[model samples]
Target chain A: MSSFEVPEVSNKQVIFKNYVVGKVNDSDLEIRTSQLRLELPEDGTNDVLVKNLYLSPDPYMRSRMKEDYTSYVPPFTPGKPIDGYGVSKVVLSKNPAFKEGDYVTSFTRWEEYSVIPGGNGLKVIDTSESVPLSYYVGCLGMPGFTAYVGLYEILKPKQGETIYVSAASGAVGQLVGQLAKLAGLYVVGSAGSQQKIDLLKEKLGYDVAFNYKQETDYNAALKKYCPKGIDMYFENVGGKMLEAVLDNMNKFGRIAVCGLISQYEKENSDGIHNLSRLISARITMRGFLQADHANLQPEFLQKMLGYLKEKKFVYIEDIDEGLESAVGAFVKLLSGGNVGKQILKVATD
Target chain B: MSSFEVPEVSNKQVIFKNYVVGKVNDSDLEIRTSQLRLELPEDGTNDVLVKNLYLSPDPYMRSRMKEDYTSYVPPFTPGKPIDGYGVSKVVLSKNPAFKEGDYVTSFTRWEEYSVIPGGNGLKVIDTSESVPLSYYVGCLGMPGFTAYVGLYEILKPKQGETIYVSAASGAVGQLVGQLAKLAGLYVVGSAGSQQKIDLLKEKLGYDVAFNYKQETDYNAALKKYCPKGIDMYFENVGGKMLEAVLDNMNKFGRIAVCGLISQYEKENSDGIHNLSRLISARITMRGFLQADHANLQPEFLQKMLGYLKEKKFVYIEDIDEGLESAVGAFVKLLSGGNVGKQILKVATD
Candidate 1:
């Protein structure tokens, strides 16, 4: 039917312009409209054409913007679509594993529609649950899994232990504090703004939430808030914040480093002083990636759904409308301008 | 018999004059002669007297020289006899656990004779073997145990992995390099002096050894020596050397921070930069104390003794004769002037 009269299926995409040095600017990414062929290739390639619903612009994406950044993911190619974790609905499928109308989460591009080559990175989502679709990119997706693995595996939180989460209002930190509290830990958090700090205490049920901006001295603030000292630290922000955590960490304390969002922008960062405290205090500091613990995904999804259904967990997401807001949403995320998990709502089912 | 004529039982001791600021100087300790009454208490105190043999002036002891250093052991009490790990001969005993003439390794004062109340920390050495008695303090005691725990427990060496030990010719590093080789690892090390470097390569059998003092850039040095990035690091000297190791650390690397000898004398240590690499590389850096792994001691002692007897392991010690050389030996040890395990030979049994 489409061959006779082609539908006006012009796909709007956020394109990577070039690799960035320090902080990413508006010029680093560009919004461009490109023609779409809504049909799969007949060359034995199992590509699935999907209509993008939501795109999660996480802090980790900034790493891909660097030319030399090597990690689990390869660097995004300049002049092409930027891909990340997103929610999508299958429009057409050549892959037997996925079919039309199948709702799923996959590594998709920042575009109105994406022909996910060979249906790679796609995982079918169970739409039978009443959970919001965007939660796939927020709580039930990568960030949530990161929070879970970091807390349970690395930190190994014990009941009554004090767990301090930095960037407590951000995507991963929000869930970490909530999960720590469920595990019978005394949860403390630090966020950039008063609004974010209030959200941490009032909504997230953190025992103590402080505005790091208002408090000039991080060490003094930690000392005041974490009076008994921090038993475990969920580190997101790096530099001064991490140093302060080291200062307040108790003997045999553990640190789960999920991100260093603060240092990503700086070419030259101030090195951590008092790492010697790591020796005197007998601390175990580990850097972790969620991909390493993919085996735990099935249990993670099930348990997180149970928490959501029982009204024990509330996940907050800041959604910017359409593919046009993709760059702005990511920029806001890196600059600490957004509240909760930042997402770009490309379309609605 | 003493009623007719008194014996010249003068206890010549090294007394701590005061706590040190910056590097410890000659004035910080004093050698004094005090008379001793060579009799055990009859009031059921369970005291044991020991004649000191070899005293280990380990790098960790420098921390105790500071007035405010808090750790597994308390700071050395100024003006009181400096207590340390030593090889000794039990002179008199009311305690049934240790009798007179028992050769043991224990926490003994730096003196000709020390009254160890209740014989606490007295671990009797099995002197049936032909190994040197001074070996008790050097390889078969605390230093050797530190090496064992750091290598097998902390680094968790895999066969064919590269392990780079800083302060390679020192007490702990010497044993660490040897143990790593036994574990089927490629071992590299760094020392301060050319003599120490030669000792590491020629005597200790390290695959590669470099004099860190001659290398201006530690990162470059590690790159040259450790062509394959280091998988495990036995961290002894902290600061710039540690920073360089971080740059050369392979993904999923483990750093066992045993000591920071370079930082012990500094009032303000240059903080560690490039810690963000920990996150990017997913590295695990841990600080450990040997005492915490005391359960592994029996196995360590037996295995090490076996290695020594088999001639598969060679332990070298630099002995400074008499209690008079105690302060000088300690200075040399901390300054990296002494090669191998630095020991003060008191009244050798």
Candidate 2:
């Protein structure tokens, strides 16, 4: 289709009905159909009209659902389309950088069609035959870059060092464990279910994987898994996991605080009692956002692409079909109902 | 006295009775008299025998009283003389670095006389007419160097930033406030009593100081003092104070974990409920030891000596007389009973 070709189509969008509190339910989001003329505006010089293909359901989206919250990213506006990282196919482009039939990744709304303003935060995806296009929003995208920066930059992993990762089968945690193992470190991981633990050990190549749900004592579990003591901790689920990891950390250990998924849905967060151990063990804990690390994308893509081609990295996605399933998929993500990266397939290419 | 001269003297020493639990009491230590020959050992080329002048009663010493604690410094042996940072007058020296009548500072025991091995951790006092000898055990000693490294090296304070310090009127806190102020930053400090709060505001030049004992809610107290939100927090008394500080920290804030005096005496530590703020605010919290930054001492000394000479830095000391008062002073230090830096005046130079 040319930039001037217009078509009257029904655009289905997932709208944010109201601000959420406590646990999110599917009723919080409502799908509405609106008619959109699929064509560029007359003065659209730097805009790209894209057809959304896949939408990502991330834990960070939970923070954005709150009415009033302070975070690295802004909260979603009520009554507006929920926007997040998505893989889209450009149908009409007035921007010189993007052409018709080019697959691009950008922050797009949870709608079948989206008009994204050109500038920053837009990347044209390389359509390679080896990898799936949906992976752009997951393993090869934000989560992958997060794991790279956290392990290499923040943790500064050394060979033979021991690493412990919480929520170990999640998108970022899976990559963190694999990257640490590739760096010649002993890696241990914890997940919510036995199936996830099995996947972490069998598929992800983790040295040891434990189901946190089965362990009566989190501290004892950490001690059993990381016998020599944890040198680096990839903190995904905070609260008790953070406290337990602190107790098992070695002297001069480092903790990369990527996400606190456990406390995201709670009105009042659980208290971490073992924080004083950070002092006794002389630990360094730092929190970071992947958006701040855009400069490393090229390097991250090159290495990740190589690992993917060589079959050295493994990724799994629990993809839900259609925009109607997005709301349910997101709620399931916060409740740990979905395994691996939870993605919404909006439209088929 | 010559290095070969021997004198039979009855040396009164304070000995550690046993391992302590919870708060330290006066009964945990006992005074004993032992005969000592004030002469260098046979073929001892690097030994220096000295007469103890002043001994510092620090919070870190509380951890040393535990039976099998792991730290940068080892625990004090039970049924032996307790060792700590002290100022001493050299009585005999086999090392060329020291001679009789020269004042030196080292990790000396709580006794009238001590024989210290000479090479490392010992620095000869400049014997400047401007500063008092007792200052070596407080401001110009371990605590002083600790503040310098934490603020300049770790926190990396910039001008016009806001800083909050807990236990603000003590040895390290008072100096940290003054140094931060000199660096052109707004500083706030919190102490346990009104007297210490007044000392911080009136004498130490803190922009704001609060008595945490009077505050019904710690988070509200932090908001009142640090209205701009804390840019850097010098953590000393941890537990509740740390939780409150974390709640009020600005985006990209830094926390330098110096000591957790509140948790040191507790069998089970209080939980910190606001650690999740580290992720939203992109905070970096690191625990450090002063021994790791020996290379920065030369620059620290030059600047600190200048500040002392120019009357830009003010230090206060609660001097307790004799080794008999040492036990009471140490117990008092743990309970915040003594003001400023608590020190035992073993003997007057």
Best DockQ among the predictions, by candidate number: 1
| CA lDDT, candidate 1, residue A332 | 89
lDDT for B227 (candidate 2): 86
> Per-residue lDDT of B122-213 in model 1, one digit per residue for the tens?
98888897788888887888899989999999999999999999999988889999889988999999998889888898989899999888
Question: Top model by TM-score, which number?
Answer: 1
Off by over 4 Å in 1: A1-8, B1-8
Q: For residue A240, give model 2's deviation from the true position in Å.
A: 2.0
The single-chain TM-score for chain B of candidate 1 is: 0.97
Lowest-scoring 10 consecutive residues by lDDT in candidate 1 chain B? Answer: B1-10
C-alpha positional error of residue A305 in candidate 1 after TM-score superposition, expressed in Å: 1.0
lDDT of 2 by residue, A1-349 (tens): 5645667789999999989889898899999999999776667558888999999988999989887788867899889999999999988888889888999888999999999976246689888645898899888989889999999988999999999998888989899989999999999999999889889999998999998889959999988999999999999988888888888899999999999999988898888876767777889999988877789988999999999999998998899999989889998899888889888998898
DockQ of each: 0.75, 0.65
Error of 1 at B194 (Å): 3.0
In candidate 2, position A283 carries an lDDT of 93
